[model samples]
Target: MQSNIKPVAYYLPQYHPIPENDYWWGKGFTEWTNVTKAKPLFKGHYQPRYPADLGYYDLRVPEVREEQATMAKENGVYGFCYYHYWFGDGKQLLEKPFNEVVESGKPDFPFMLCWANQTWKGVWFGDFQNQVLAKQEYPGIDDYTNHFSSLLPAFKDNRYIKIDGKPVFQVYQPLDLPDSKVFARVFNDLAKDNGFPGIYLLACNVPIYWEPEPNGFHGVISYLFHSFRFREKNTVFKEGSFLGKVEWKWNNFLEGKAIERRKKPKVYKYEKVVTKISKWPKMNFDYYPMVVPDWDNSPRAGNSSMILHGSTPDKWKIHFHNAVNYINNTSPADKFIFIKSWNEWAEGNYLEPDQRWGTAYLKAMKSCL
Candidate 1:
């Protein structure tokens, strides 16, 4: 392992599933079913396959993980950061692969969890897309303490990565988190209580929207802007009737207004957004961001949602190279580089080997990592 070089880590959620429509998207919603009782959220798409199938299909299946491990070893890549989701109230989501790695033998790579404590509503399996049934709200410092008390043991695992002699832990939606200070304090207290000395609590602030104000807790925050949709549209949805298209002339008027609004520049201001977040003394980098190939959740659109059209592998490669160059030239060598995901099929931003592109994205990652 290249200890001196900052590792390139992936956010690998073990429960990321290929939806067979096991949840709310099917006949479960039709009026014909008066006798039907309970149903899965994505009832139209996929079934709940074994958790092992998730890792097998997405990562370990078809020899992808083996291939990745071989490639990482060849490339001097340090580790893969599995997004460990521990339901603090005694529920473990997708602990199989990690357990297997530990039981069989030590893994070739080091790993750790981001403490995806935000909530559990089953989006992990592609069943619940934007249909968040519940949220594990910030349960205050006490809950975090209880949560970390268990998590500390996992941190002690030899596979966990450490920064400055401290284990690295990530939080997926820190912005959604109600209190940032209390969160930081809880993490610190937990680390001290565990006698781990220090903890690197990295917040996965993808868009840099909830940029923190410059404070001592800046070290706890890490800027990793995840670009799910970087594709530009010829038209903007400027002031359309909120109730999807109405009468013909009314729709034309809405279309004309939208066209007229096009005079404004569509270029995203990354520097400004990063600047806003960086002002808080947070660990801001010129993010070599990842872009989703596409994001058309219309499969779940029986409930009515906009379709994300137009995403090609070639265009995705452009974003991938941009990320690589940004990391190679822009980001600090000593700082960690992150990818949006190894698997996030629902939103369409995935690095996993998919049927559409095969290992094209993985090849792209090789050039980058």
Candidate 2:
């Protein structure tokens, strides 16, 4: 019998309720001045009253929360892998919905953290478009250490599943803070100090290519290859050592230059991250890769630096099936298939049903698994 482990959805709980205005910004305090000042691109996009000003950021609304839970629970979704954003300081935003999910006494499925350590500015919380709070300053190790210390209780909870007995920690921007070596040491040591054996640190290797160190730290290495090129046909990868040496050939960007002023590299280059990862023999690893509907964050970045617009729910299923096939064929039955998100509005790659095709994406996810 096929293992009961249905595919897992990585939910990046933006928790931005549907905004009244057609504009993308959710309701909250927005710093239009700073946003417009950041770059010329924000001229028309950055408005004084953004989506945040409309109260869409409030996930506490009954209708909003119900929609989220119901949508996630719909169509045989195994569970949600919440992208837990930590400020690495005392202040943490958006913990409310997650807290409610856990403490609401509702039947919540398994969830884990992706530790979005990227700098958060008003653009997100409507604080400042151009300027973000510089939290990860020099001696960044100390900042994250303190943040982890605060999150110890949540880290140890049973809901927080582990890979090979070590708690899984996903880093949105691994290179933002200290160098890779320091990050590796701090993560392992801190995790062990917190009574856990070690941490399975997963990083986003989208723009930055990652190769496991010859003597790399123990953890899971994941690559967020969200593009149509990777999805195209005849992309054959000779299965082998991706560490420091893996190659690929494809057109990374689907859209043209004038549309978004984002230049698409003629030769879309990338290491078959998973292919390389599969070659590792001694290390314990899990593929926490992502499936994207499309890559159009034009709502945020006016000029589409990276665009992939032709991805439909049906098209996305190919990646879904690819992940499932990979896991079933390669890893054991219990392996987790990490998705981009259940709801990432800015980027068009959300599983949540939208006005364009209500429930089409979620249904695709359901029927596939």
* Candidate 1 residue runs with Cα over 4 Å from true position: 1-78, 86-92, 99-106, 120-134, 206-314, 329-333
Quote each prediction's TM-score.
0.59, 0.66
> Per-residue CA lDDT of candidate 1, range 1-369, in tens?
324444454644433232222243343232111112212233232211111222334433435555655655554445676766655455555555555555544545677676666554333222433345434655566777877776766677776777666787777656556676777777777787777776766655433333333311333333423221221132233213432222323433343233333322222233333332222222363222333333333222222222233445555555545544444554432445554544444333455455445666556545544
Highest TM-score scorer: 2
Best-performing candidate as measured by lDDT: 2
Candidate 2 per-residue C-alpha lDDT over 1-369 given as tens digits, one digit per residue, 9 for 90 to 100: 134545556665544342321133445422222222233233232222222212333466545656566666666566666666666546565566676666664444556677666655433332223344534343478876776776666567776667666776666655454576777777788888878888776665433234444223333434435323343232344323352123332222322212234333112112233233323232244444455554434445544333343456766666566666666665631566666666655544456655556677777777666
Candidate 2: give its CA RMSD in angstroms.
8.4
**Candidate 1 minimal-lDDT segment of 10 residues:** 30-39
